[model samples]
Target: MRIHKRDKARRRMLALLLAGVLAVTGASVLTVAAFAGQRQPPAQPAATRMGTVACGDVGSLLDQVPAAAQPAVDRDLADLDVQVADAYRSLMAPGAGGGEQRVMDALVAKRTTTLRNLKASAGPDAGLPGDLTGLASCGIRRDLVVDASARDYAPDAQAGSSGSSGPSGPAALSKGSGNRGSGLGRGFVDIRTVSPNVAKPARTGSATGTFTSQCGRNENRHLNPDNVIVAPGVSNGAHHMHDYVGNLITDAFSANNRLARAGTTCSNGDQSAYYWPVLRLLNGVTEKDAKAPGGGQDSNVGRILQPADVQITYNSAAGNKVQPMTRFLRIITGDAKALTNGPANAHASWSCTGFENRQLADKYPICPNGSRVVRTLKFPDCWDGKNIDSANHRTHTAFSQANGSCPKNFRAIPQLVERVAYDVPTGVRFAVDSFPEQLHNPVTDHGDFINVMNRNLLDQMVSCINEGRRCG
Candidate 1:
């Protein structure tokens, strides 16, 4: 706590050097303290975050690759993801300041090799540039991760209805409780402060039927870190734990044939896979997977919460009668790296059980005692009608237009709507598991699923939608 004359002189000089640099959460202050020879925590966090490693997203650059080349390309893509995660880990270590350039340089070399292999896998017909120069290099991308507010959770008394049990009297968020290390406090906002922002679009099509699937919650404890759609046969591809329902035997090694043979949690015998990153209550509790790959090892900690209710439904489109989703069609609804990748593909929607009309895309909602946190993901329903999947895992499926109509050349399919609600404890702060660099930002939340319905069930779904009847 004492300052010497020589130290004061050095601080004055350093302060001049960082004249314009500013941090709201004490990162810059710590850098000045480093001159005092005191051990300090790393500043590679969202508060005073250094940044994230980013390469040009290669998947979007691809038009289409040969069907035979998919497996190798998927593996190489998964490898690139791991490389960036490793680089972030290094950057988070103490005394990693001047080492940023070295770490990024090494990451670029690794990505270059992987991009080369990926291009070769695509073969001559895939139409990839020979050098892949711009796509191969990676650098630190400046991401804005400042906390919007540190205000306490004080719900308005009138915010709760007569029948509701939350936030009216003594039920309030615990004071001074947080998990700042895992990015919790800053990501949450009191739901009472938000206004209604949701509006239902008008529909005019004759096909008014809706099909609901009774897929049970993850009562089976089926969890893993693999992503079968994007990173098949690659372990730890997601770098986080996922709550899975539907398919029984899904993993990174699961092929279409293997998935087809697996049992399901769906009551109708649907063998499809539906999964998303698990949400966690950041209350400093040790979980079973604390030392596991997708848990603490990947910078995702705290107690995982099981959904109190999970609803999966499919609705008809406004354009025409919905067609059957091609068996084994793969779809990813949100961007897992949205924090660094930008909001173009980000689709995570957060709300409270009763305050669902005020959906939040970037901040987590602080629900009252009786209320629970909710995550709703609406999957794309327009299909290209040719491939079961695409090189980018997105080109084959697309969202409907604002009027709920499919785009030109795209066929209308039953839109999948998933709503999962979590009973987060009173006063507890929470966040969904995300990539190490993503820092559990709500924007990085996403979901993945595949269609493995049998022919009879597919026909039933189409018939129900066309007939304007609600059937599960």
Candidate 2:
């Protein structure tokens, strides 16, 4: 009876355990079926899909992509290259009133198309690499150009027309002093008359004897005794001679002065004009900086000038007002000597003594010791306080202010200056001699100059990147 009871209990327990296992398995299957029945998020649209890749995300995507998909990747890259080139060409094209809209529009449109194509190629299931996505999100759009008629892209309608005659060859008047003689006029010369009766008879003339006169005999008087006219003086010569001789010198000097002034004004204006475009580029990068701190600022900062507030402040300051001239000289010469170092000097520590005193002691009594206040201050230190290194007061004056004197080897490159002013991040050291040679003739096509410059910069950047250098 005991054996029978034990066997029965064992059998019942075994059956219960098997039933429990079966029940759990059934439940899991049902749960999985329910999940399967519900729709998953619809796969990203094929048109918009980036194949799960992002900008600058090309490396990883390139890795995992099968050999079959390599062709597609290559096609996409080719398309991007073409679009970018087109955008650049459009930008270089002349626009209404020579405004920036056309170029900007082309860049933006090309950027959009490239992005769209990239997305389409990257399907919902496309396994894109992480780095590529970050790059894609960089907001580097090709549609930088816009219609000249567009209100936003259009230059200020109220602003006065640019006095510049657009890009042109060297001024005709700038040739040389010798050219002035042939092309314009020589140093003043006077016309004189010799009395036939007093003058020696010409060999071919009918005059009889060697005629002479008391007036003609006085060589000093005949030659206009008062050659150096300190004030209005009488010249006993033909009125035409006096008028032509006297006025010629005065007119030539006056014209030369005018031309010099115009040239200087034009050069200054060109430098300042570039500030606008550079500001735009910096502003865009700043937006990116706001989104991703400490990412591109180092590279981009090299291209941008200090902000307006900083510039204004520097100008307003008594000691620093002259700094811009010095800074300009330094840039041209690449010499530190042109830059100065003194308390009152724009590049010196004393310039900021006033601002520092006001901010640290007067304004913020409650701030804790060693606390960093990040308020924006105009003319913070001559140019823009941000560019200057407050900590390194000894060397390296801020970008806003002058540093040491101009270097001994300071050589000027006008094109490089223009590039810097324009915030072109590439091609600072291109060969200027080659510019004219490669372009055939610079007088007719200025666009070629710009193209060659850009290409040179692009090549440099590529080379740097290939060498494992950081290329913002």
Give candidate 1's root-mean-square deviation (CA, Å). 12.9
CA lDDT of every candidate: 0.70, 0.20
Off by over 4 Å in 2: 1-63, 95-99, 124-472
What are the per-residue Cα lDDT tens digits for candidate 1 across 1-472?
Answer: 0001122443353333222122213432222221123333544443344444555566654556766778888888888888888987887666676666566667767877898899888775444456665565554543333232321111111111111123322112212222233333545677777777665656677778888888899999998988988788889889999999999998998888999899999999988899999998767797899998988888788888999999988886563688888899888998886665555566668888988887766667777679989998888889888778777788778888877778677889998889999998877777788877676767677999999999999999899888888998
Predict model 2's lDDT versus the native. 0.20
Best by TM-score: 1
Cα displacement (Å) at residue 324, model 2: 59
Model 1 TM-score relative to the real fold? 0.81
Top lDDT: which candidate number? 1
